[model samples]
Target: MSGIVTELWPYIVLILVGYLPNEVWRMLGVAVSHGVDENSELLIWVRAVATAVLAGVVAQLVVDAPGALALVPLSVRLAALAIGFLTFLVIKRSVFAGVMGGQAAMLIGGYLSGVSLMVP
Candidate 1:
């Protein structure tokens, strides 16, 4: 038991270090947002920035993927994203449906293109 605990100590510390800051900010947000309006300009700006950041991350992933993802071409990713976005818009912006549709499109496109999704 002592040896096992020693081996896991680094991971435990890492988890705590990673989790504490997010937890602190979450609690702070809850504390300070009690009387804030959802439609406030500040909130709206924050939402927009957050969305932009998420989109940027996705774009980065699509454009410069590493390892197995690098094998998939750029055209296929863009096509998948387009189909997924259209599906999302058509289905009233259901995120689950959008993600699933995108994944399905990628898989089908990969298959038809004779590209293996698995790392060799």
Candidate 2:
């Protein structure tokens, strides 16, 4: 319905707004990386900024995920982060392992802490 779409428009805009900066950087990086040396200052700065942004995003997700983090204690969140880090190390930076391990840790830790949702 028109009313529903009006309500959702802000959320759609927010998603595109959040995504645009990262996607732009990615496209620019890809375009430049072909000709740029790996040790170049521009590449180094881009890598550093990208790393910082990724870390900030992950931290925000862990600390402020609306429904999920609110249902878990800080310790559980920290433990999940640690598990994700360890999984990354053990798997030689396998992104899938790190993500799945972190999610699994959060789910298990939340249930163990009796702070999770009670669903049938």
Candidate 3:
């Protein structure tokens, strides 16, 4: 019993540490957003910043992926991103559609490039 409890302690601590900060902020946001306008300037700015950060992260991944992803050419990744973005716009900004389109593009591009390399 003692050994089991000790072994479980670390997992419990990890769960708490992983969830507490985000949960606290989310609860606070819910409380504070009660009277906030959906179109408020501050909210709009926050949304824009969040979107920019997400874009930067995606760009970083596409540009600097390691291991298997690194094998794909940068041009292919950029082209995939462009296709994804256009698909997103065409589909009224659906993230799922955008991601699927990008993934499909990457797969097709990677296959074609790999074939070309093998032929030469």
Scored by TM-score, the top model is 1
**Least accurate 10 contiguous residues by lDDT in model 2:** 111-120
- Candidate 2 lDDT at 116 equals 39
Task: Write candidate 2's Cα lDDT for 58-86 as tens digits.
Answer: 88977787775687898899899999889
Model 3, residue 47: displacement in angstroms? Answer: 2.6
Q: What's the C-alpha lDDT at position 81 in model 2? A: 93
Better of 1 and 2 by lDDT: 1
lDDT of each: 0.87, 0.86, 0.87
- Candidate 3 local lDDT, 6-77, one digit each (tens): 999988887799778668988998898898899899899879998999989988998998677888898998
* TM-score between model 3 and native: 0.62
For model 1, residues 1-120, the per-residue Cα lDDT tens digits are: 999999999998877998786789899989988999998998998889989999999999888877766767889888999999988998889999899899899999877877875677
Candidate 1's TM-score reads 0.67
Which ten residues in a row are the worst by lDDT in model 3?
A: 111-120
Error of 1 at 82 (Å): 1.1
Candidate 2's C-alpha lDDT? 0.86
Kindly report which residue pairs in candidate 1 clash with one another.
Answer: none
TM-score of each model, in listed order: 0.67, 0.61, 0.62
